[model samples]
Target chain A: MTARIYITPKPDILDPQGKAVASALHDLGYQEVSEVRIGRFVTMELKGSGSPENRQRIEEMCRRLLANINVETFKIEISET
Target chain B: MTARIYITPKPDILDPQGKAVASALHDLGYQEVSEVRIGRFVTMELKGSGSPENRQRIEEMCRRLLANINVETFKIEISET
Candidate 1:
C-alpha cells in the first residue's frame, strides 16, 4: 500500500518561508499573489498487508515523528499501490 | 483563487530526510513501512482573476523559484476560494 501525508502549518502560525515566496512572486510581476503557506508532503510505501491496524499505525507515525502537532496539522490518504 | 503546489524530490535522488523519518517510524514500531519520501506542499492565494494566463504564470513561478528542476518536480492544483 501507499500512503500520503500532508503536514501544514497552523493558520495562526507565522511562515517566513511562505512570506518570502509570496514576496518573490510579487517581485517577479505576479502582483496578484496574495498569500502563500508552505508545508510538507510525505509519501510512504508499506510492506505488510493493508489493514486497519496498519492504517492506525501510520497515523500514529504522523503524530509522533512526521508532524509538529503544536504548530502543524496533518492529513493522511491511503491507497493501493 | 487558491492554488496548491506539491514539490517532491526526484525518485533517483537521495533523501536523507525521508530516510531519517523512515528510521524513526521503524523505531516506533511501524515495521511495515518500507520506504518514505518527503517533499514540500505550498498553498497560495491569488487576488486576480483565475485565468489561463495566471495559471501559466504560476507554473513559471514553480519552474523558476519554487522547485529545483534538477532534483525535484512539482505539480500544481488550482481552485476557487
Candidate 2:
C-alpha cells in the first residue's frame, strides 16, 4: 500500500516562498502566473494491505507530525500497488 | 488558470529527510509504513486561460527554476477555475 499526503499553507497565511516563485515566474516571462503557493508532497509505502485502521493511523500521523495544524492543511490519497 | 507542480526526488538520490520521517513513523507505531519520500507541491494561479503556449512557458519555468534537474523531477497539472 502507498499513501500520498499533500500539505499546503492555510489560505489566509502569507507564503514568502510562494511569492518568490511567483516573482521568478514573471521574470522568466511567465507573466500569466499571478500567484503561487508552495507546499509538501509526501509518499510513503506500507508493508501490508490498506485498511480503515491504516487510514486512521495515517491521519493521526498527519495530525501529529506531517502537518502544522494551525498553518497548514493536508489531504491524503491511498492506493494499493 | 491554476497550475500545480509536483516535484520529487530522483530515485537514486539519498533523502535523509525522508529517512527521518520513515523512522519517525515507525517509532510512532506505524510499523506498516516501510518507506517515505518527501517532495514539494506548488500551486500557482495564472491570469488567463490554459493554453499550449502557457503550458510551454510553465514547463520552461520548471526546467529552469522550479526543479533541480539533476536531483528532482516535476509534473505539472493545469486547470481553469
All models, DockQ values? 0.87, 0.89
Q: Model 2 over residues A1-81: C-alpha lDDT tens digits?
A: 899999999999999999998888788777777899999999999877678888888899999989999999999999999
Runs in model 2 deviating more than 4 A are none
lDDT of 2 by residue, B17-38 (tens): 9999999988988788888999
State the local distance difference test value for candidate 2: 0.91
User: How does chain A of every candidate compare to the true chain A by TM-score?
Assistant: 0.93, 0.95
Candidate 1 on A1-81: residue-level lDDT in tens?
A: 999899999999999999999999888888888999999999999986568888888888888889999999999989987
Best-performing candidate as measured by lDDT: 1
Could you tell me how far off, in angstroms, the CA of residue B31 lies in candidate 1 after the best superposition? 0.7
The segments of candidate 1 whose C-alpha lies over 4 angstroms from its true place after superposition are: none
Interface RMSD per candidate: 0.9, 0.8
Instruction: Give the chain B TM-score achieved by candidate 1.
Output: 0.94
